[model samples]
Target: MLTILPPSFTLTDDSLQELLLSSSSSSKSWSAREEACYLIFFSGTLPVLPGSHTASIAGQKEEEEEEEEEAQGDPLSESQLTSLKEGLWCPDCRAALLAVLSIFSPGSLAATTASSTSTSTSTTTGAASAVEARALLLQVSREQWKDRTDGGHVYRKRYDVQSVPTVLKWIGGKEVGRLVDEECADVDKIRALVQG
Candidate 1:
């Protein structure tokens, strides 16, 4: 069974301390051997989208409000909405991550497992089984770029990640593949890398 370690930021201070202690001690609780496949997402490269803003014109406030309401009533196209969500980035790394998660999340895996078992006498193939196995997903914050020595520094150094939006694939603690920056924006490419 593969054990996916949650991101450090998500853990409480006590849990983090315990995790650190366990990691540092000779008897490692979370071994790479246990979870052969892992995916690390360096999220620093992706630009943060600005919060929604409201502007008021001194004289034309009512007219501007009416226009704004009309504009809001007309929904944006899928591509336009995606572009707006992605902000300055050409490709949406966050969207790509969400896509990957949708496919490989625990819920999806459970569904796959149930379906495979319920089907006729066909046994699960190695590739399919591997796909069914949940891969560890870790998100490294963009703030890590500011302090190179902290916040996933070990992984950053090990993977030779120079920028954000880098997705590194590891099997048995060894890096098997990587997709950097805009390259990681493709869901098909990510699926191929993970399955490959």
Candidate 2:
């Protein structure tokens, strides 16, 4: 609906450029090229349609009936969807997830359990939080990626991100501060500088 609508809800190129400029004002860690790619894929004009109560009244009534029918039938579980949404909405969480996705595959994470004795390089290294974060990354779907794009956000594409340093550079190190705790990482210092 938003895609077909006029430039009201979607971001314009000028607005996206301004957003990038403002973001770059903080640190030189983000990749302008990557950001550009993100904008090209997701940015668009907003919807110009006006709301009409009468026009929507019949649709709402039909939707309510459908909802009631769905409620009577087997309802879809939303826990996974909710978790994915939270992870995408939270910058720090998404950054951390990107780092994890860089290292491990979803099948590997799902196959291993607390009781599993098959130890791997990813499972053996770093903090448990890091491991768990990676596990969560495997659970995120492409639909969530679309949602992030709709939110005017960019994510570190697993294949595009070559290494940790590259990922750091891609998002601009300044934004990296959001991923770590104040005590754990120098987020304040990162925020003080602009990135190219």
Candidate 3:
């Protein structure tokens, strides 16, 4: 499981171009398993629409109608709203990733081997369990990937990232599943894909 933590930013074409440039030189040595998984961490925001007109009464009426339709539609539940605010609503992408890692035990192996091989340089004091190892993996991955760039931008032309709190899952560089916008925010969906 190799997670690509792209600089945190909204999706945009320019941002995608930047990502292409920046990641071009990075190592792509990670191997793919039958259960290989890649998590794309990004700021989920709706794509900006091009073209605009002066505000008019007709436009205002349209806006009101849309709002009315939304109101009539199914609204987000309390937990969903809280998840959105906490940035955890993207199908619990982070949690799902962690769950998958826990099942695979790669992070656990890496952490244990590193700690046991070099006690003098080891940051952890005692033997770490798989869960702890997974946490360390996430922490280290974030720290390593976070400061590489300023941030990301929303580029809808390539990745259809429609909102800020989105999580995309890929296998062998092909998108197998995703949680974007207000679709099913269940991590089970991601788990199922990973399990497959």
What would the TM-scores of all predictions be? 0.44, 0.20, 0.31
lDDT of 1 by residue, 1-196 (tens): 1222423434323443344334343343333443334444544222111111113324655864565455443223345434533642323454453334333432222334323332223332233334643343344544544475554455556557666556666544466788777666554565577667
In model 2, state the lDDT of residue 8. 21
Each candidate: what lDDT? 0.43, 0.26, 0.33
Top candidate on TM-score is 1
- Rank by lDDT, highest first: 1, 3, 2
- How does model 3 score by TM-score? 0.31
- Give lDDT tens digits, candidate 2, residues 30-93: 3444331121111121111111011112335575345434434321123422343253433433
The order by descending TM-score is: 1, 3, 2
Give the total clashing residue pairs for model 2.
Answer: 16
Of candidates 3 and 1, the better by TM-score:
1
* Prediction 2 global C-alpha lDDT: 0.26
Minimum summed lDDT over a 10-residue window in model 3 is located at 46-55
Best by lDDT: 1
**lDDT tens digits by residue: candidate 3, 143-179:** 3233334342223334554443344554444566765
lDDT of 1 at 51: 14
